[model samples]
Target: MFMTLTADSGADRAETWVERRRPALHPRRSWASPEPFVRRPTEHNSGEDVLGAMPWTRSASGYQRITVAIDVVVALAVVVAAAALGGAGWLTAGLLGLLATGTHVSFVAALRGYERHNLGDGPAEFQVVLRSAVVVAAVLMAVAFLTPVQVPREAVLVGLPALVTLACAGRYVHRRVLHASRARGQAMMRTIVVGSTVSVRDLVRDLGTAPHHGYLVIGTCLADVVDDEAAQVPLPTLGALSDIPQVVHDHAVQVVVVAGDALGGPALRRLSWALRRAGAELVVAPGLVEVAQERVTVHPTAGLSLLRLEIEPPRRRLMAKAVLDRVLGLVALVLLSPVIAAGALAVRLTSPGPAFYTQTRVGVDGREFRIWKLRSMYVDADRRRAELLDRSDRDGLMFKMAADPRITPVGRVLRRLSFDELPQFWNVVRGDMSLVGPRPPLREEVSAYHDAVHQRLNVKPGITGLWQVSGRSDLPWDESIRLDLRYVDNWSVTMDLMILWKTFRAVVGGAGAY
Candidate 1:
């Protein structure tokens, strides 16, 4: 129960003694349960001797090499393809093409596109791609006007856009591959969690919560308290903070994460030095959780790293979102008119109800609006809802049966493909909804909502959002709320587009369709 840390093998002997006493504390090398301190590799990174050596930096190195190869290939292909299409001489075409390609690569590099991405930080890379494209376009246009080089007009207009698309597509392919690799238990950092017992447990739970995040909690080195109760809490304590260097070397740790009041700057500096020798990077997980990276800007003032938080004005964002919703909504309505019509007819004939179902749902600011959908159930389906409440198998505030008898045969198919929701394009056009926002809450659902849930009302209800792309009816209520609230706080045009892109996949897969 008690151990003293000496300069040498003393710490190793103690850990061995502890592990022998509590074999359960020593998790098997394979992936284990979702609890903290499981010795199992997937208990957050599998295999200590083998997989612990599989650091993220190595995978990142390989990923970067592939990225470079993709960039070069895309750049060359775009230039050659554009030159063949554009009416320009070889010398002029080559010069302009190379210039555009070089400039974009440089811009992207400066924007940190090549940097390692955090897990769950969805699609932030695409924004960097767009910005780099804009800069390349502006520079090329300026050069054409200022000089007598005679740049090709068609090439500048069309080729530049094509180049951007190709580069982004290549990045997307690489990103997907990288994610897959991480999911398969490759590409993760061998992490040593250093903090108070509570902080280490919390961090383990948080880090372990998202397995694909690639932070493999191989071991722990606790802070402050010296009772060494870390093992009792069950994280494999590699002794005290003083034994960090030994632990890092022993486990081949690639990352050493400091949580809570673990070490002061001087102690951290010393720790960093020791970790550097072991080739491990140090990370500090501040207590502030779930802050969007976009909102936080780092400012160094008098040697202090200050986090400047930018507060977005609710009124301005909502106004801009309203405009986008109507414009896109009108376009969708026109495009999907035939599908909507067919869905309505199918519902009417099969369900013996009005073709269109319009129910009052709470929108932004608790305003009630008639949300439209093609009927997906019999005429008395809503009335029979009370009878099914006793037999509900649902998550949180949601009530959905995997196989509901109220659903008509046609309704089942409509719901499966989400064809019945097409009428909501009109709601989007009328400003009753948004292309991307929170779910339109039912009147009873809103009444049951707590104070924090009202933040969803700050923005208009969305048609396809984080909730839609995520498992719809199948997702737990808490997780659904978290995703919706995350969107509400961090909504952007790019985020909306990302959600829309993901929505297509979710719909096609029918992942959570009832």
Candidate 2:
């Protein structure tokens, strides 16, 4: 006969059943118990999960709060230092403090939003800094022009930009350092995943690939089964679902990722509640794959956790793009006019083509725009492209030839120094491109792109971008695409400036250039 063991106090009280089962079974007894075993019923409802009963651990939350507080304090200190160096009076110092505070608040808000809504994949450090800098710059400019404070116009113009730049650069360095520390196994959260073997294994694999998330999954709890096959799960199976509380207590788990579908409603509820009572943060990993966090929302309906996934609309920041491109582009063109003239003269004397080479390239949407570049190849370079196809050295939708014979003698020198790209400043001025964005693909290259690759066209192409300064032509096709997608997902003004700065160094170093 089969025996059905029922816990009366609800599933959460089921752990006591383990103790109860031990007593009823005599030592060396092999026969099954004929009578059904039932425990005394309690007030715990079926809807209550382990997460609900468990309180989030104070350690992780406390550290995050402390880190944020320190960031704010350091930012304020930097502002005070700036004021001291600038020799500003009380009003000026006050204004600088206000700007610094606003920047810190905005950055913290963006980071929190990214963590809560972005599903760990959001804008890069450069983009966040860019947005904050833009806001700070606008506020300082307004105060300089409108306020009666005796702040020097030059000081306002110079000091504000410098502070904004420094703040962003410093933040980027901090994030990089933090990530490096995490990679070295410092400042990490110990986590345990509770679910089926398959789902938990996959989640562990994904997490292992991204150490920057700072979650170290040290153990897995098999909630449903307890067979040898279940032991095949990648992580060490601490115990069954009933053993979660004990395992959590023993391992000092900071976070619990409960895969709900694998555990069933009742078991999951108990596990969640147990985790909460044990002071561990519960992170539910819904089976949704490849969905951006920005597209998901948590709506609590009655008592059930409702997850609503919304598709993001295509970006509609055209006015911002136009204003940024034209303003920065005009300034760049004016500043680099002498260099452009010299490049043009070199091209004219060295090659049988105009100083500037304008070609129709794919742009935002499916539109085509005439992109300008200083002549970096022979006049008949296009005619020679077909012959060089067999020598294509790169991958993906694009084609690259490492040693194309069509390049003019002087063109190689210009390309090395990125001098041939000087004329593209006019493209920026014409609003066909930005100072920073994805490199525009040739029309033929766009035609070869897969469906997902089309997302790169969501924003205007740039003169200098992640690809240019990162490794230029040296990066593999996959890496190039990854960097491009990263840029598109997290576009910001700060990133543009950072890329521009890097581009200058890259050009001077002549690394990874043709």
Candidate 3:
């Protein structure tokens, strides 16, 4: 028995996975259960199977290695460019460039910048490069001040930013390649989960949902759960705790993620020993969900381990973000005045309504603000909304329609390319919205929100957001909410900038645009 992992059936497998959505990875079948299978050295060659490079795709490890190479090359290029700009002698610059490169490589290694967990991770890569470059800059400044050898002011001023930018760009490209490869079922570790069925279910759902994390769950080692033998999970059950090593070797598993404590410390230790012998990596899940590694610090003391988590990002960063939003919004409104004017004109001429549409939307902390958009529908579109509710094909509290009868001819084009939302730049200027944040919900939607969902109200709503760029009207309601919640949890200036950059691509593509 074999089945595919689908997002819609994001629950306990049993019989549901077979009947629900049918898409993911390649169409190839994987074992649905373990049989009287034997392990032979010639039967399983990981290097020949998983690590073999197809003409179009490389292995995940190979991708990581290539990314490492790209980073060093970027560092060298940045150094050379900086030296050329600083008018330094070739020999002198070459020596300094090599030194800088060495420093960069050393810092990245210490930071685990090229680790599998960090590979294709844009924000992590960017943060590491920036912090490392800052340290490098400071070291140079201190050396110049103390010693007779003075570093070039031009290099310090230009090189740091250049190195950070180039390094981040390389990481972005690496992530892009990895994501594309993963979608095609390449560049992912053949992974297995070890835990109770319920605990493993959550982990599997999470990994399936975010396949870019690069773990492809092939089978699971489900520990004994009382009375759960009457239940069956969608995942292939390899065996109990005793059969782990054989299961790992037989399946050519590269990674084993231990979720919860179905296997206690001593048992887990023994399992780790088995995995080590099998040449597989082990990840013990802390059971903390959605926490960024940046917020975590692990320390070992007195034969014990402690994990510390910071509650939130610094207040100074949030303050700076507010300042940036207002400044950028003001500048954007001014720059996009002509485009706004043209869109308004189109709306006014094509529809029998005012060029602007305003609606009361809930913002940060349950506060309400009137959101503005270039009216893309008839004036009475709101009046006809109730009748169209039954036709909605989306999940959650959101409503959408691709063939919505209310939209005017001109409004259709504007909505698709997202030009209609340009007036919200003014909302961003008014501080009622932001350049990047959660999507503003209607009063009714906010009223229906669960307590946990209210976290979306922690920051001001946005003109564009994770929800908008994700799929706009076409996204399923739950995924939209997930993306928004994710934004609320992981908002950072760099993350915001990355979203904004992808926003351009999304708008142009009009993937889920209504």
Best by lDDT: 3
**Residue 473 CA displacement from its true place in model 3, Å:** 1.8
Candidate 2's TM-score: 0.66
Which ranges of candidate 2 are over 4 A from the true structure? 1-165, 193-202, 219-247, 258-269, 277-279, 287-316, 403-405, 408-410, 435-437, 464-513
Candidate 3, residues 345-390, lDDT tens digits: the string is 8888877879999999999999899999999998999999999998
TM-score (C-alpha) between model 1 and the true structure: 0.84
Worst 10 residues of 1 by lDDT: 25-34
**Candidate 1, which segments miss by more than 4 Å at Cα?**
1-55, 117-121, 224-228, 231-234, 301-303, 311-320
lDDT of 2 by residue, 112-144 (tens): 623322222234543554565566556656776
What's the distance in Å from true for residue 72, model 1?
2.4
C-alpha local distance difference test of each model: 0.73, 0.66, 0.75
Residue 206 displacement in candidate 2 (angstroms): 3.4
List TM-scores for all candidates, in order.
0.84, 0.66, 0.82
User: Whole-model lDDT for model 3 versus the true structure?
Assistant: 0.75
- Residue 178 displacement in candidate 3 (angstroms): 2.2
